[model samples]
Target chain A: EAEVAQSPRYKITEKSQAVAFWCDPISGHATLYWYRQILGQGPELLVQFQDESVVDDSQLPKDRFSAERLKGVDSTLKIQPAELGDSAMYLCASSLTGTGVSYEQYFGPGTRLTVT
Target chain B: TQLLEQSPQFLSIQEGENLTVYCNSSSVFSSLQWYRQEPGEGPVLLVTVVTGGEVKKLKRLTFQFGDARKDSSLHITAAQPGDTGLYLCARQGGSNYKLTFGKGTLLTVNP
Candidate 1:
């Protein structure tokens, strides 16, 4: 099925602690995305990456969050001093490319993060 | 930012029943996609509608795009317990495959 891969399916951290999640997109996919899904709500984009460069990060909170894809195949998202409000499901997705009008995206099982 | 509104945020029906959910947007969509997510997992794409007034059927599930390109609907016929999940409607906005999703409609098909 060639699915996207995510690590640490679940995470629990206390406030003021650091947490990190990892994702590996399907082979040959050039675009990757990170999203946060609150309970009972749809996923919201946190960042988008094209190859090794960031395309958009308008919704990402810069102060405590950071993401990077050094080789463009795998990515990591980190949050320092995690807040209670940061509790959510973190998802990673990948697509063949991101230049067209529309394309199919494959999602990973996701890492559920909980900050107490 | 574009706003998407989904109706009937939650629904529950007995097995073999029929139901429909809707997704409406404040801005016109160039393309719309539907996804289904089960508990403890990420969303899976169900279908994509690109043309105005387009209709696509996947077995017992039927999807329709509004003629004005601002809304879409998903209808499930003879839904079974396996049909229970959260249905999400998403639109491709701006350049480079940026997608904005609706809040989603949670459906529970009781057996």
Candidate 2:
């Protein structure tokens, strides 16, 4: 089975430092998602991208958090001046399509970020 | 904001016991999905219940969508230690591009 891939499985950074996570979706999947999960809470969507275009980012903390899918196949999520509240598990998921009855998302192992 | 509420935020049971987790929402959903997440890993899709009053079975797991389409349940029969994980339910509210997820139910099945 083709799995979604993520990098820097674990990270620890001082407050105000920068951190970035990478994800490569399954080949040909058109939709990618970035979600942040605080300990003991569900994953909250940070952004969604469809073929290099952002579909939704209403919940994204625009000031210091940004995500991009430059080519629409692989994606990067960056945080500048990370804060203590930014400590969480960042997850990446992808689906073959963002529509229809087959819109099941496959998730990567996820990147755990700790901002002290 | 659309909200999904999952019940029994935490559950613990002995192996071979039965358990059920629920997800409820006030906003109607076009589709509902259940996912399981292990420690240090992202969630994996378990099942999707789309229609009102629909029931689907996968091995020892059974899923049911409420008649009103705003609630769903997952029942695991003869649960095992391997079934210990976080169970999340999500739905597409206004569009397919966005998903609203419920605070998951954490299940711990001890052997």
Candidate 3:
């Protein structure tokens, strides 16, 4: 089965440090998403990308977080000056398309970020 | 803000037991999805319910969407230890195509 790929399964950084996570969606998928999952909670959307353009980032903390998908196939999410509260599991998911209602979402193993 | 509320935040049952998890919301959704996540991993899609009052079964697991399209339920029969995980319900919201997720139900099937 084709799966979304994520790098750095775990990351530990000091407060105010920068951290970045990468994700490669399955081939032919046009929709990618970045989510943060706190302990004992569901994943929360941080950003959504349709192809190379951002579709929604309302939940993303713009002041410290930024994401980009230059070629529309792979994406990178970066958090500058990470805070202790930023510690969570960052998940990446992809779907076939973003036109109407799509059911399935392929998710990666996720990058667990811890700031101390 | 769109939100999904899941009931029975945590459940622990012995093997071969039956259980049900629920997801509810006030707002209507175009589609609702159920996912399962193990420790240290992201959620894996289990099923998606679109039409109202739809019922779909996968192996020993049965899924049902409410007639009003504002609620859904997942029932597992004869659950085994392999069924242990966190189950999440997500709804597609707005034109952004972003998914709003529920807090999730953590199920532990003891052997």
Candidate 4:
């Protein structure tokens, strides 16, 4: 079966360093999302992209976090000068359309980032 | 902000037992979804309830959407070891494609 793909299943970085994670959504999916999950907590949305345009990023820490889906297929989420508090599982999900009401999201095995 | 709350943060039961997990919110959603996530892996969708008061069944699992679309429930009958995992409920937020997820119910079925 087709599934969302993510890279660097595990990452370890020091404080004040930069880190990046990548995701490739299922074929023909138009909506992509990035989320962060601390241990024992639910995943929280960070950014959302509808094709190549950002539809919701209000939850993203813009000062240090950035995400982009240039071709609307694969996406990259970057954190500049990462902090210890940034250690968490970064998940990527995609849906068939931009409207969440119509389709179910498919998630990829997340990148577990640990900032020391 | 719209938020979903899941009850019974953790559940441990013997095989053949019956259990139910709940998801509630103050905000109504256009649709609600249930997912199961195994350790070190992503969540997999189990069911989606769109209409109010809808009920869907998958094998030994039964899902119900509240009459007001603000709550949902998942019931499992004769649970087995394979049923152990984290159960999450997510809803589509207002006028947005982003999903608001509940903290989730961690279930451990002892065989």
Among these predicted structures, which one has the highest TM-score?
A: 1
Candidate 3 per-residue C-alpha lDDT over B1-111 given as tens digits, one digit per residue, 9 for 90 to 100: 778999999999999999999999998877899999999889988998999999999999999999999999999999999999999999976766667789999999999
> Model 1 — TM-score against the truth?
0.98
Which residue pairs come into collision in candidate 3? none
For all predicted structures, in order, the TM-scores are 0.98, 0.96, 0.95, 0.94
For model 1, state the Cα shift of residue B107 in Å. Answer: 0.6
Q: 1 or 2: which has the higher TM-score?
A: 1
Give the i-RMS of model 1 in Å: 0.8
Task: Please write out the lDDT profile of model 4 over residues A1-116, one tens digit for every residue.
Answer: 99999999999999999999999999999989999988877889999888999989999999999999999889999999899999999999998874334577889999999999
Please give, for residues B1-111, the per-residue lDDT of candidate 1 as tens digits: 788899889999999999999999877888899999999899999999999999999999999999999999999999999999999999877777788899999999999
| Candidate 1 lDDT by residue in tens digits, A8-115 | 999999999999999999999999999999998999999999999999999999999999999998999999989999999999999987345456888999999999
CA shift of B51, model 2, Å: 1.4
Most accurate candidate by DockQ: 1
Which rank order by lDDT, best down to worst?
1, 3, 4, 2
lDDT of candidate 3 vs native? 0.92
Better-scoring candidate (DockQ), 1 or 4: 1
Candidate 3 local lDDT, A9-96, one digit each (tens): 9999999999999999999999899999999889998998989999889899999999999999999999998999999999999988
What does the lDDT read for residue A47 in candidate 1?
98
Top-scoring candidate (lDDT):
1
CAPRI-style class, candidate 1: high
Task: Report the number of backbone clashes for model 3.
Answer: 0
How much lDDT does candidate 4 score? 0.92
